[model samples]
Target chain A: MPYRYLEDIATADVAFEAWGKDLGELFAEAADATTNVMVEGLASIKRKETIDIELRNPELDILLYNFLNELVYLKDARRLLLRAYDITVEKEWPDFRLKAKVSGEAIDHARHRLKADVKAVTLHRLSVRETPEGWKATVVLDI
Target chain B: MRAQLAVPESIKKISDTVWEIPASYKPGMLVPARIYATEKLLKEMDAGVFDQVTNVACLPGIVNYALCMPDGHWGYGFPIGGVAAFDAERGVISPGGIGFDINCGMRLVLTNLTYEEVKPRLHELVDSLFYRIPTGVGSTGFIKLSFSEFEELVEQGSRWCLKKGLAWPEDLELTEERGCFAGADASKVSRKAVERGFDQVGTLGSGNHYCEIQVARPENIFDGNTARAFGFTVPDQVAVMFHCGSRGFGHQVATDYLQVFLDVMERKYGIKTLDRELACAPFNSPEGQAYFAAMKCAVNMAFANRQVILHRIREVFSNVFKKSPEALGMSMAYDVTHNTAKLEDHTINGRRTRLLVHRKGSTRAFGPGMEGIPERYRETGQPVIIGGSMETGSYLMAGLSTGAGAFYSTAHGSGRTMSRHQAKRTYRGEKLKRDMEARGIYVRSDTWGGLAEEAGAAYKNIDEVVEATELAGLSKRVVRLLPIGNIKG
Candidate 1:
């Protein structure tokens, strides 16, 4: 049961489910689906660039916010459209590191378009769970 | 989904215009619950807000409505959009209503330079503005206030800025209560609030706070030919708008007073509440007076904060355009608060009693020719600013006299429709930035996670929300603004 967007408000709970041989593929699929809800052409990104991210949250919900926020930061500072290619999420000794490959073309008025500018990841109705088949997380975004 | 609410036994819908939760509803309620939202929006409200609002209704010595505004949401305890008035004689004050950011509000600036004149320099202007204004979480400020000066600021609000040469005296004319709430006793504020506030004047705190550039609509312009017609011209002219509030000092004050209220709610007055987060002391009571004094301190601090930001903006324009701020036409349009409680004379039960009106997550929209309004624009009405998220456009409105029944208030921002968690899970930061850039909204932020949390989709539609406010006769739209650039903290 890979994660999927809910019919709720932009901030409403979204369901995600995916199973991969390793953590990298699982995260990549999750990232692809997440960005897909925002715009078209996630697969169009050439995976030309890679961003290194490290985030630690007492809860998985906060971790998700950090992950998404990093993507937002890169977009604003550098006018680049990014599609997550590969992702690695690890938890050990109370520290977590998430590394991923991302790629997008430089922003051009003729190309990319804007939809929503999210403010902050909220704590409302955030959950991450493991299933027999794979993993599922339900999160509400603060659009 | 429609709003799923857990209505406490204490609450009852008296009519379409009113909702009440009795004291017996939750055992600690000093007064009944009151809400002022339309049927449609009310039906869309979050259930947690109902619990929080009822919890506030049960506070000690609250008189009149333990009110909830149209955009109410589940907050710390009193609900983000909740408002309640305590009788000056026996009412109580709680920090929960004022929120962590005291007087967190919106300010609009109209320039002599129309949008067309500034359009060519839009990129330079946004970059300069972002650099000039300090922003982000735990951000510091350029102006630092001394202990005695801080006291004056707390007591005098924006007037303090005028005295310090940071503002135009005429600017105060367009501010609420002339930018000051009287009876602010600086001595009552906690040392922690004072310490935190002393150096953070003129800084923008993080989380949904922003400075934006917008263009006004043609028909809704109030100035007509007066030159202040929202400064919109064609598509290039830019009007500056920002939303901020008292910074860390305000948060500390709210924290301090909330603790005070909780401690004495039962012991000093035998008042109890279902939620300790809704703790309060009577307005006329010693505890209430103390809280009110501290709240005013935060209010004044916010005024000074905005004043300083204005100065910084002027400096930025001068540097970027190579002209004086005056030459750049960087003058303030108006400043108004969304989260605050004040004592005003309003006709209640057909009698004009000085009732305390709490406008949490609501703006004060006084009607045309109100005595309190400044003389220059008395015919038009008080300026009302409604800020939308970065991706969406914000609006400037004018108050209508018809709003007197609701204590002259209107909605603040588009209410949150999506939670932050859902946003991060659904949207990637880089992708969102690309989309925003394509729309011509240049954004500068510190954290990607923070940016994702504030995606514009998280909020209700601004146009719909503003229309609802008008339909409810809360405020009349004057000008609509589309964002060209933004700086978020």
Candidate 2:
């Protein structure tokens, strides 16, 4: 399950309904509901940090905006307070490969919580699907 | 994406600073359709910005009114707070009325250190302004230039950053057109806009550029009475606000002048358009004076890319306040521009003329003893800069002569209200960066899907859209700032 809020002007809103026995746990629960909409006790941090994400696109909505602009350039230039514990996908030929693992707490605010600075990931109204209950995507963020 | 056009039962409310629309609602218009909003911001518009300001009062030398300010939206073909002028000896000059980000502006510096000496190194001055500023979307900068010095920086902007020592020489007497724009013409630009502006000079591109760090809100510094008419004075001091434009060589000179005004619209003037994205030409065409001299060389390459990002923000406040970027006083409290197209002069039914205008996403303003501003702001008139996202709050208005049918436009930001795919299916870039760091705002970005597509509930209420563009006279407020730290791109 992945869900987030705030919509109108400087927007953000995400939804997930995953049955993920494929498409890599619905793209790792939609990148952990898009980094839990900017860090909020991703189940109390203990994933012990793994970080390794790679993306190339042909079009899965520009491979989900190059996998969320590489988790927003590792949370705004490497202050890294992550989520999305795992994702492995490969669809070569013009490209699409992502391998991810993330943890948190380097942007400590009595322990991770900072939000919205998003500035691009638009080709306006982008979408992705592989339905019958498995993968779904709808992206837009130019905050 | 469901508005096949509707809002105009011949509008009429003319008494809250106007709102007309008529000319029988739509038959190749030619005048009548004024807006300026505030009946609660005209019930937050979106009948496709009143069908693109009545399809811009059916173009072809339009004059009188097509206005629309209270920060209107639905852009691309004029409607981001649109404005139109046209009549330099019989009108027309649309590159969608100057938008593809040509002179996308805003600049305010002020400093003298307060906020208790910059709140114990505000996170090492926002991580040294996010590692010496260089922002998103194919971003690149470290001063590169060179293509005959980016053609003398599109022809001397910010006086070529104070002759390359990079700023300070009284920051070009507080910018505006002084940052260059004496009708720029770097040989009417284009070698693919000088190879996409050779290495993006001092970049901060991407949609809605930024760079903030403000304060002055102790009830608007006791109600701006002590910005001491510009020299400011304490009250948590520190200011730096930013917003960018004219990047990617102003989107390849508005896509090479909207394909040279659609190949000279109807073979040298037979004009016809209900929207080929409003591609226009006439105003004594030669491709509209070479798209107004390549839109004044994308407004002097966005005033020399914000005078080299204000010389890398005075070298990050002269290395985090150790002082010496002229004793860190910083300077330049004016540098407006809200998208381009100039010529100006005004007066209209009292005669004067010399129009052209444009404005897209608006700004000019003018007023108080005008002489086209800049003589230390000719008695406080043109400053205007609006920008308000990154957790809302921004204003600093000034222009007032009832803005003469908008040659003195206004409203430039705090418009959109969701639609970056409805703010990425409704928020959560880490819970909007942990609720803008628990309201002390400290964002830095390259992406969290571009920080959840900038979530301050994705805009509007820039104090009720600059109080309905200063109660429709189109510009008046004065000071209000607020943000504390940001750096998005």
Candidate 3:
């Protein structure tokens, strides 16, 4: 997994940090981290459905925030647990945009072993920066 | 202590139960971060509270001080239990401060039956409650409203419930905002929020959301007059308490606005904050007003949600006991929200100003004589309902005059001392359930994994937390109710 849990951020909320050689892997792994928080049985979710996510912002950090929050919205609004993979971030300067292809299936209460429901992706201490090695994002999920 | 949470050494002690982090602690802070906690409680607090509270103090036009109740814990933008009043003219409004669970609150309903009367039937009642009230993740509610009806509910709040015969007129009087928040704009609500809310009117969302049956202990009643006024008549009198919010409707509303504020804060309004989660626009600005209008819809949705649940509880009790709800004395005591931002007039420097008070993980503890409080409670003040862990007991208290000093807010609950991940690692849900059963407390929940995370040990002792609130003079303890039955989401 390219993403790992951050143990010390909060006592009630969950936190994680994801890194990749490029934005694609970074955002995808972040989604995985988010998905894993609510369901440990991520492997059981067959990708029978695909979702196209598009978001726009002038800032790289805000764009990352929106991308993660969109997944949370989908889970609550559409009853879908989406995982992003085909992710691309265009940092065309004064404007940053994200277009991603994500897949997951409808929530199955019997099949999907549920954990805490991630209410939303919060921007508190949310970090999206380009490191010398790659790109890194820090996320805190409100449960 | 973990390095991630360390209260800075510069915090100055103001009293035995008060501490202040002066603005000098941070360069741009407009006021100090005031904390109501004993030295020991402060030591047990996560150091992250220091940063979050100070960050709140830095918000533009924040008045007085950014205060945290004794039950303060680390949260996204505001330290949970955070209370801040912003000038309506220049201060900013951040959804982060109100929390994603908009108007998440506590509703206490008093019943004529005693603990002994309900103890034997506890298991059956819990089973019925669990079956009747949809809960857990993706728990679809039974009430399905058309979009137009849903829009009406959003705008009318508990009043809609009254019309549906789900609530009494008296019920509205006991609720904050009289069960209906003004300024809700259905047009401003997103369709996604409406869709999520459609079937979620009577649901209990997962993670700390629950419906518990409790009995007031006569010995625990500190103020008999106040307790009677709030409907607690005798020891062992049963009361139903549920902690829930606007469900996914509020979640989407908050999610949508957080993005809007992030874009508008810097680009259009020139506002700056330490964290993106603290994104906000000036309270009077177009974007801010729009968010507030939409937020009111969610607030009303939550009020209606609880009212509908209250109706379900009444039905369950009436069926189980073979009595009408009124004959069972199943009238509501009071309802108060922990997460909300509302426009209210408070005396500032002896002058009343309409300030937008944002309370997160904190309950409004309005003192006596506040017109916003229910008429029956106006003389005694608002009832501040604080929930405890399943094994531990909950509390009922009255907002004291001293509460006005802290923006009339008090601790919401026993703050978490350990993370859910930490508790799940050490606790087993089935084993905990057995343990609770051994102690005479019945536990019914959707999943063991979820139950494991809510282990009582994961939180600070509620007795100590409630004591802190009382001793801090923020609120006065009235009675303590021990849990006999619980239905968790």
Candidate 4:
């Protein structure tokens, strides 16, 4: 697992920590963790559609939030059950940009077992820090 | 000076129902932090509630104490069950104060049918409801609106539902603000927010959101006059209650503003908050006003959302019992919003002033004399719908005169005692379903994992929370609602 659900948080929402050898992988893992929160068995999600997401923020943390929030928007707006397949993060000083390619299809209630509808990505105690291992981000999804 | 963000330990017991953390406990705090909970509840209260409430007290121009209701639980920025008011001229408005599910509220409907009358066919009724009322994640309503129509819905609130012939005229009368709040500017709402919300107006969003068919317990009615006022005339009278809000529309609006406020709050407005999630701008500033206008659109959208759901439910009942809506005597009891910010006049420090009151996971229990309540309920007071877990039961309550102490607010529900992950680990969803079935409660949910996360053990005892609210004179019980059928989203 590239990300792990954290139990230290409160009951009102879900918390998880994503890790990677770099920012790109960290973001990809984070996206997967978010999608996993809503439904399990990502392997069963046939790639009926591909969605391209791009986000720009001067700060890495805010950019991360926008990225995740964008996923939530796509899920609700297009009714897609998504799983991030690939991500690339480019950051230089005050600029952070991310482009992610995710694959999924319209939600089939008969197929996909919906777990929790993530309302949004909350910045409450949102954390994105660097360590020797590469990059780690702690986030919460307001479900 | 560095800000203190830790759980305060300097709290002083004010009464059995009140505790105060003085402003002196935190250097930047403009006011104290007061919690309306029993000693027992406080003993087990999450430390995050104390920290968040104190953070709220430190906000600029906060009036009096930042209060947390009896159901207070740890949440982002503002604790769930938190209530605070900011000055129009000086204070700021935080999106976090209302949370992402804007206008997340509850509305109860009363039916002439009694428990005994519906018991034999309860299975059929539940099945029909499950089939008729759209629920679960990705669920959509039958009614689809064009962009122009969507804009109209946002601007008109519940009135739009009535105009579309989806809601009864009596429904608006029993709603907060008569089902319409002023200052709704759909133009101010972002296109993305509007787009996201357009299709989700009637969906029951997931995570603790549900529509329940409950039977009124005759013995649970504490006030006959109030119970009669609410249309709960006899024991076992059935009621329909639902909890939801503006889906992705509200989320997008809140997300858009939180980013907007973050970029310019300190540099442009000189506003400072303890948490980034508490990002806010002065209430009078352009950014704040824009957010307020957009927030109003979200509020109206949520009201319309529930109104449409009520229409669908009425349709289902009509088909099942073979009675017209009027003949069934299906009337709304009252609709109450748990998350919102409204500018209202309140006497603060002797003078009456307009303050923007923000309540998150809290219910407004306006006393009998308040102007905001409906005429039929004017003498009894506002209906405070306290939703309980499907395993336990829910409550219908009425405001009391003395409830002004907590700014006319009470607990929203039995707050979470265990985390979702913990609950899932502790109980099996299938087992829970079987257990509830054995008790005659029919629960239909999309996923067993979802059901596991919302098991009864995950929440604090509803009875305790209601007892605290009543003992503190925040609200009095009208009747307890035992869930006969529940549709979990």
Score chain A of each prediction against the true chain A by TM-score and list the results: 0.72, 0.29, 0.95, 0.94
TM-scores, in order shown?
Answer: 0.74, 0.32, 0.96, 0.97
Q: Which candidate leads the pack in lDDT?
A: 3
Ranking by DockQ: 4, 3, 1, 2
Model 2 local distance difference test score: 0.71
lDDT of 2 at B57: 87
Over the stretch A46-139, how does candidate 3's per-residue lDDT look in tens digits? Answer: 8989989888888777788778777877787778887887889887777887899999988898898877778887877788888999999998
Checking candidate 4 for backbone clashes, the offending pairs are: none
User: Each candidate: what lDDT?
Assistant: 0.69, 0.71, 0.88, 0.87
**DockQ of each candidate's interface versus the true one?**
0.07, 0.05, 0.64, 0.79
Report the error of model 4 at residue A47, Å: 2.2
**Candidate 4 chain A weakest ten by summed lDDT:** A85-94
Q: Model 2: C-alpha RMSD to truth? A: 22.1
lDDT of 4 by residue, B1-489 (tens): 111323356889999989899999767899999998888887778888888999999988899899998888888889999999998888899998998998999989889999888888788877777777677777777778887899899889999999889888889988998787888988888888877778877788889998989998778777888899899887789988999888889889999999899988999988888899899899989999999999999899999999988898888888888999788888999999988999988888889889999999999899897988888878898899999988899999999889877878899999888888989899898999899999988888877878888898888889989999999999988888999888887
TM-score of chain A of 4: 0.94
Per-prediction TM-score of chain B? 0.91, 0.38, 0.98, 0.97
Flag the better candidate by TM-score, 1 or 3: 3
Q: Tell me the deviation in Å of residue B203 in model 1.
A: 0.7
Residue runs of model 4 more than 4 Å from their true location after superposition: B1-7
Shift of residue B161 alpha carbon in model 1, Å: 1.6
RMSD, one per candidate, in order: 9.7, 22.1, 1.9, 2.5
